[model samples]
Structures are given as structure tokens and as C-alpha cells.
Target: MTVDPELLIHRDADDLAFSVAARMITAITDAQSTGGVAEVVLTGGRVAARIYRAVAESPARVEVDWQRVEFWWGDERFLPPGNPERNETQARDALLAHVDVDPARVHPMPADTGQSAEAAADAYATELAATISALNDEKRRAVPAFDVLMLGVGPDGHVASLFPGYPQLAVTDVSAVAVHDSPKPPPTRVSLTLPALDRSREVWFVVSGDDKADAVATALAEGDVPAARPKGRNRTLWLLDEAAASKLT
Candidate 1:
């Protein structure tokens, strides 16, 4: 069932980040209350970093068991594992390091370790498959029913590394795909395909800033943009600040 997107506008960037941080904590806590590990997909961006920092510093951070939360990335820079530009590196520095998450559940996309982008994507797909397989249950799926899948919308309306009109947008057979000649910097990258992103139970688009207002409006209007594609199984939220939501009708 396709879920309608919900719009949540905040006063400012800080307010947006804090609101998302609180919602994230509550979501994780609710998921864990059912005796299942909470699966969350993280995105990278200035706003996302703020949200992570807020999560790390929140007084209610202890409401959920950090060790029971599984961390995954929506996309990553194809740089070395510890490179400052890598989403994994930023996430660890911002939030993961401060939490008590189990090392075994931290699934970062493959980095540029002398491997081709295609190879890295394949490896990630395999890892996703193996992880899902390990559940060994009747309700088997290609990927986990993520409790929360957070994404950041670029000014160009791209989600993750999926740029508009990119060939990767048509790839539905794979869980992840290699992206080359990206319009943004660090052209070579790997990202979860729309199919994988849509597997989540809840998809949150945490965006801020006036620069993103146009794209956010376009996406909300169901324009021909990649950001308009992925829909959550249970809920889809467009969490934005006043600036980002300004252009919306």
C-alpha cells in the first residue's frame, strides 16, 4: 500500500533537527518495545549531522537501548573507510561513537578500497541479502523492514546518490547500484536503489535551508524527480524547516 507523505514544518534548522532527533528516539523505542531490533538507514548532509549531534546530546537518548539499533547508510562517498568525506565517518563522529550500538550491526556501504564502484555495490547488495537471510523467518524479504529510513534531499531533488534522469533510477532488480559521473562531487559512489529504499516501514526526508525549498516543493508536488519515488510502507514524512517548506503551496 502506498502511504501519503506527511509534511512537518519547523521554525528553523535547529528546531527541525531537534524535532527529528526526538521523533527518532521515540520511533526506535517503539520498535524495540516489540522485542525486535530497530533498523535505521542514515543519510549524510549538514542538516543530518546536526540531527545526529542532537540525537547524541538529547537528554532522552537513554530511552532506548542503543545496542539494539542497527545502523545502515543510504549512500556514501566512495572514499577510503576513514576519510572525513565518507558518510560512515561523519555518522560515527557525530552520533554512533557516542552511543552503545553493537559494532556487529553497523553496516556501512563499501568504500573505495581499490574496488570498482560496481563491485562495491555488488558487495553491499550481498551483505544486505546475507543479513536478511540470517533472520531465517517466514516473512522473508530482500531487505529488512527498516523502522526508519532517513534521507536528505539535495537542491537538485536527488535522494541518496540518485540524481534526476540518471540511469540508476531505472534499476529495480538490484538492492544497490553503482553511480558514476554524478552531478555532485566525488562522482564515483554506491547507493541503495529505489527498491531497497522503499522497503522501509517509515521514510523520513529531513531537509532544511532555503536552498532546498524549490526541490522540496517539487518533490511534494510529485514532480519528475528522484526524491518523489521512494515511499514508506507505513509512513512517509517530509520533515523540513520553514526555509525548506517555504515554496510549498
Candidate 2:
């Protein structure tokens, strides 16, 4: 059952990030209120980093039990663990460091370990499988339908390192993959494939800036782009600011 994407426009980047932080708090508290821990897959970008900071500063953040929430990344730059450019590092610095999240539940994609990218991907795959198994006792699957999966729409219509027209977008067998020679900087990365990313109850694309306007329009249009193909099981959301939504009709 494919659900159409829901477009949400905020005044600007700051407002969009703040709104997303509030929504995230609501989702987490709602799940916790139902006596279940919520799992969220986070993306990286300027807007995402801002969202994290907003979350950390939001007074409503205390409504959710941070320790009960599980954090995962949609993709990560395969750099050293503490590299400032790494998504995990940015996330921690922006929000996680201030939150009381359990260290055990924070699952970051593998970084430099003197192993091949494929080997690192395999290691993360194993870890994800175990996490899903422990989370879903009945299904014991490789992936879990996470409560919320946030993605940052790139200027090139890419999501989770899945570039437009890239062969990695054709992948279906694995939940995660190792990207090499990426068109963007820091060529190597670890990314959750569409299959894994799509395994979410709600998927949110947070985008900002006029530079991403065309890409946002393309994604919202009935297109075959990889960014448009991945949707959530229950809901697909496009959270954009004025600039990013400018090109959308």
C-alpha cells in the first residue's frame, strides 16, 4: 500500500527544524505512552543538524523518555569514530550528548576499522539483524518497521547516500550497503538500503534552502527518482521550508 507523500511547509529553516523537533518529541512520547520504545532512523545534513539542536533545546523534549528511544543512522560517512564530519559525531554533539539515551541503544554505522567497506557493511548488517530480532520477537527479521525514519533530501535528489541513477539504488538483497567513489566528498560511506529505510512506519524528509528547491520538486512529482521511491509503510512526509518548497507546485 503506497501512501502519497504529505507536504509540510514551514516559514524557514529554523522553523522547519523546530517543528520537526516537536514532532519527534510527540512521536517518542506517544510510543512511550503506549508502553513501547520508539526506534528512529536519523539522517544528516544542515537541516538535520539544526533539528538535532532544536530537539536538544526544546522544552517539550522532557515529555519523551530519552533512554527508551533507540537511535540509528540512515547513512554515515565512513570516517573515524570521532571525526567532526561524521554523521554520528555530529548527532552526538548536537543532541545525543545532552540527552539521557542509553549507550546500548545507539547504533551507529561502522566506521574505519582497518577492514574493507564490504566487511564493515557486513558487520553493521549483523548488528542490525540482532537488534531487529531482539525488538521483534515474533518476526525475528533483518529489519524493523521503525517508528520514524528521517531523511535529508539532497540537492541531487539523493536520500541516505542513494544517489540518483546510482547502481546502489538497484540493491534489494541487503538491508545496508557500502558506497565507494561517491559523487560527493568523503567518497566512502555506509548506508541503509531503500529496503531497510522503507521499513518504517513513518518516513520524513527534512529539506531546506533554495538550492534544493528543484530536487524537492522532482521528489514530490510523480517521478522515478530513488528519493521518491522510498516511502514509509504508514506515512510518507516531506518537511520543507519555504525555500525548498519554492519549486513545488
Candidate 3:
């Protein structure tokens, strides 16, 4: 089903990043107050890098207990653990390194070390299941309903690592899957399937740049783009810069 996303446009990338960072802090704080802990799924991109930097510098960073906020990635590049291009490495340098988050709660998808992408994906799924089970005493949750699941909308209208027309997007039972022949460089990745993304209470698509305008517009319109398909259980938000929102009607 195509759920209409709530649109939020900022004047520029800088503005968009800072606003998203602030909103994330607020969401984490709110969740911590009620749930004792909060879970958030992170994404990586140029805009996401900026958002992480903003979060690292924000004054409100101290308002929430970083240790109580669990961090997970939406997708991960199948490369060595320390590879700069890897989302986990970038996220650590951008924000995690600076924050006092619990290392135990920061779950990153397994990186390729000559291991098959499918193996890495299965490992991640098991990790997710274990974490959710440990945290929730009331119910046996295979996938936890994240307080916020942030995604970077690719130029090709992909979310996480699920590209348009990709078979991974059609996967329903699995919470995560392996992308073996992604059109994007690196080709291999482990990503949360649409089923996992939709498990979130809120999903935020943070997109910027004129290059992404068409994808943003197509996602908002009645289309079959993978970016258009995923929706949050409670809220699906599009956080775009003016350039990215230019083509939206």
C-alpha cells in the first residue's frame, strides 16, 4: 500500500541536517522517558554524515542518556570493518565516537571478510532477534519496533539497500537480506527488508541535493519506487532540502 508521507522541506542541506539532528534527539529523549530505553536505526549518506555531525555538536545531546539509546544501521556496505566507505565506520567517526553510547548496544551488520553476503545477512538477523528478545520481556519480538528508523533516499529511489525493481524489496518474511548485485558501487550489502523497516513506529527519509529531486517526487507520487513502498506504522516523514523537494507537487 502507498502511504502518503508527511513532507518537511528545509531551505538547504545544512538546515535540514541540523533540524533532523534536533528532532532525533527529541525522539530519543521522549522514548527514554517512557520506555527506559530507545532504539534507532541509522542510515549513511552525505546528508546523513552532516546530520551525525550536527548531532555530535548539538547542545541537547546531553539531554538523553546515550547509553540508553541503542543504535542500529539500516544498511551496511559489505567491506572490511574499518573501510571508510562502510556505514558503520562512517557513523562511528561522525557521531558514535564522540558520544558515550554503550558499545554493547551499537549493532552493526557484519562486514565482508571473505564471507558470503548471505552469511553476513543471516548473522545480522540473528543479532537483531537476540537483542529484541533481551530487551522485551513482555513479548517475544523477532524485530523490535524502533522508535525511529532513518533512511537516506538514494538518487535511484532506493531505501536502505533495497533498490527500485530489486528482488530484496519484495522479501516479506526475512527482516534482513543480502544484496548481491546492487547497481550501486560495492555491489554487496546487508540491508533491512521492507518488513523490518515497516516495523518502526516512525520512519524518516532524510534527502538532499538536486540529484534526488526526481526520486523524492516519484516517491511522493503514486509510483512503484522502492522508496515509496516503505511506511512507518505511525508516521512516515520525508525530510528534504529545497533542492530535493523542488520537483514535489
Report lDDT per candidate.
Answer: 0.91, 0.88, 0.89
Question: Candidate 1, overall lDDT?
Answer: 0.91
Instruction: Give a tens-digit lDDT track for model 1, residues 1-249.
Output: 668999999999999999999999999999889677888999999989999999999999999899888888899889987999999999999999999999999999998889899999999999887776675363454456777999999999999999999999999899999999989899899999999999889999999999999999999999999999999999999999999999998
lDDT tens readout by residue for model 3, 122-160: 999899887777877544445568889999988888989
Q: Which stretch of 10 consecutive residues in model 2 shows the poorest summed lDDT?
A: 136-145
lDDT of 2 by residue, 1-249 (tens): 559889999999999999999999998898678677788998898888999999999989888899889899999899887999889998999999999999999999988868877888888888888788788884444547888999988888899989988888989998889999888989999899989988898999999999999888987886766788788888999999999999987
Off by over 4 Å in 2: 138-143
RMSD of 2: 1.7
- In model 3, the clashing pairs are none
Among all windows of 10 consecutive residues in model 3, the one with the lowest summed lDDT is 135-144
Candidate 2 has an lDDT of 0.88
Candidate 1 ranges with C-alpha deviation above 4 Å = 136-143
